[model samples]
Target: MCHIASGWLYGGICRSKLRRHYSLPEAPCSDSLIHCCCRACALTQEYTELKIRGVDPSIGWKANVEKWNREGLEPPIVAPGMAR
Candidate 1:
């Protein structure tokens, strides 16, 4: 992505057709973007909320479900033995 951006910013130094029509500005320094800090704070808040809810934010639910199924655990029987 950075290479593509650089090519577009510098007028296609590498003869990339994709960089021809688009003009991009030089990338900003990290200090120039307030949104970077906001993203970090939002990520921290999400983890805190997950901890409060007693869920491991690191483990995805789909992966957990797949692991459980691999271990021969059936999905929850909603009606307690009703036929499918």
Candidate 2:
């Protein structure tokens, strides 16, 4: 599992409002915690590009995971599992 900015999945605030958003089982924010199984799909390109650059893959993964944990960017349940 991974975490990403909600806007990346839902587009910006305008798009968020345009769609009929719904909540998840353990959503942290009632208004903005729209569940998106496609969230990881949204990050594939960026992750791959970083990998192609020979960067430490864990760096990007950890940064996004940390951000989501700190900001409650998505539902608590949607956040990445504990680091192995």
Candidate 3:
């Protein structure tokens, strides 16, 4: 149940990233439809896209952000601060 519910969000996010990476004006189909039809393929494509773009998705997002910061690139999103 949790997987099904979260699928919608991840599917849309993957599709959005693909569109942004390719500067696409519109997608060939909706994210949910594509994911529903072949989720593995969609995930593979997203993973490949990340690998080709030099992001190691095996590493967590915060680590990736720290890496980008070390490289002198501003992170796309800011990390939240921890309160004591």
Residue range 7-68, candidate 2, lDDT tens digits: 54444243344223222122243223333434454245334644553434576556766766
Candidate 1: tens digits of C-alpha lDDT, residues 1-84: 886534333432322221121222323332213223354553564457445544455786576567667978763332322235
TM-scores of all candidate predictions against the true structure: 0.32, 0.26, 0.62
Which 10 consecutive positions of candidate 1 have the poorest summed lDDT?
15-24
Candidate 3 colliding pairs:
none
The whole-model lDDT of each prediction reads: 0.42, 0.42, 0.71
Residue lDDT tens for model 3, 1-84: 988668866887778776665554445787767787888887887788667666788996679979998999864432233346
Models sorted by TM-score, best on top: 3, 1, 2
Q: Which residue pairs collide, candidate 2?
A: none
C-alpha positional error of residue 41 in candidate 1 after TM-score superposition, expressed in Å: 0.2
Regions of candidate 2 where Cα sits further than 4 Å from its true position: 1-37, 60-84
Q: Name the regions of candidate 3 deviating beyond 4 angstroms.
A: 2-9, 21-26, 73-84
Judged by lDDT, which candidate is best? Answer: 3
Compute the lDDT of residue 71 as modeled in candidate 1.
79
